[model samples]
Target chain A: MKVKPLADRVLIEPNPAEEKTAGGLFIPDTAKEKPLAGKVIAVGPGTSDVKMEVKVGDQVLYGKYAGTEITIDGKDLLIMKQGDILAII
Target chain B: MKVKPLADRVLIEPNPAEEKTAGGLFIPDTAKEKPLAGKVIAVGPGTSDVKMEVKVGDQVLYGKYAGTEITIDGKDLLIMKQGDILAII
Candidate 1:
């Protein structure tokens, strides 16, 4: 399924947080941290006049706490307003 | 310390998630969910022609995972681009 956000919203597919520690030991799900990286899949039109700094296919580093999670085609995607984005990676 | 975001960014102070369950029992910190709410403390200039829909002191509902966390005056706050906000409450 495909979803598009309106206005200044974006659709992102979160990159999973590392599952292994530096020692190469697998971390349990309960102990794993949330992922803070994702790829921009879709972006809304430029904010009125300011052109969007990010574009689809840009790999971005977002705050771990950014964006709303939505299920699309059984995959988790984030729908966040543009202001929530810290920077375009 | 006060921090003001630039451009379309916003500075927010997160509201803590509930520490207790419906049964009124305290949930362990390890199991606590991230908060999805915050209060807008500062906002950047409007996104070009789009006047800001939010303002300082407005309580907002965001995605559980939005915004970058920053420490200001020993308090944790979020700095996210405006698009990450789902709605203003």
Candidate 2:
């Protein structure tokens, strides 16, 4: 079955972490948590106080530990609030 | 100068911690951090994506370490997003 995120949450498929990359990538360090890059797999219907900014197939940046990890269809993924996303790349 | 919270932020004047009391108080322990009670002193205009839910003079509950501590006009206060608030008391 396909997983669907609830209000203000988004389902993301993280890109494999690059090993010592050096160019064309913007890595922002906001706190102790590391930054990660990913692709949006699904998005929730945002609440009245929030709006969904990222759509499916959008490349995004988020905190490494920003979302909850879940397994769907034998694939690992993350479900987080839209606020957890740092930016759409 | 009086402080004004920006975006979805709210300014709160916290209630003093009770000296180990036990009635009419709903204490929610979501994590290691303790819950706190406070009065909403000011609220932001809210972003286009977020609508302000709490209003000035509203008594609210929130996590203890949820916001930044600031000293204004010789008085200490907290500034945090409306999302940090758990409920209105």
Query: Highest DockQ: which candidate?
Result: 1
lDDT of each: 0.66, 0.72
lDDT of 1 at B68: 89
Candidate 2 — which residues are off by over 4 angstroms?
A: A19-32, B1-46, B49-89
On residues B5-79, what C-alpha lDDT tens digit does candidate 2 reach at each position?
555778888886562132346566554555678899888767796789999999988875676544445455677
**Model 2: DockQ score:** 0.03
**lDDT of candidate 1 over B13-88, digit per residue (tens):** 8876552121244344333232265689999996665556668987665655678889998898998877677555
- What TM-scores do the predictions have? 0.44, 0.46
Per-residue error for A72 in candidate 1, Å, reads: 22
What is candidate 2's CAPRI-style docking category based on DockQ?
incorrect
Cα lDDT tens digits for candidate 1, A15-89: 665521223555566954533667898886645645567789887766556666554445656777667677776
lDDT per residue, candidate 2, A32-66, as tens digits?
A: 33346678999999999786767899876566568
- C-alpha lDDT of residue A9 in model 1: 72
Lowest-scoring 10 consecutive residues by lDDT in candidate 2 chain A?
A19-28
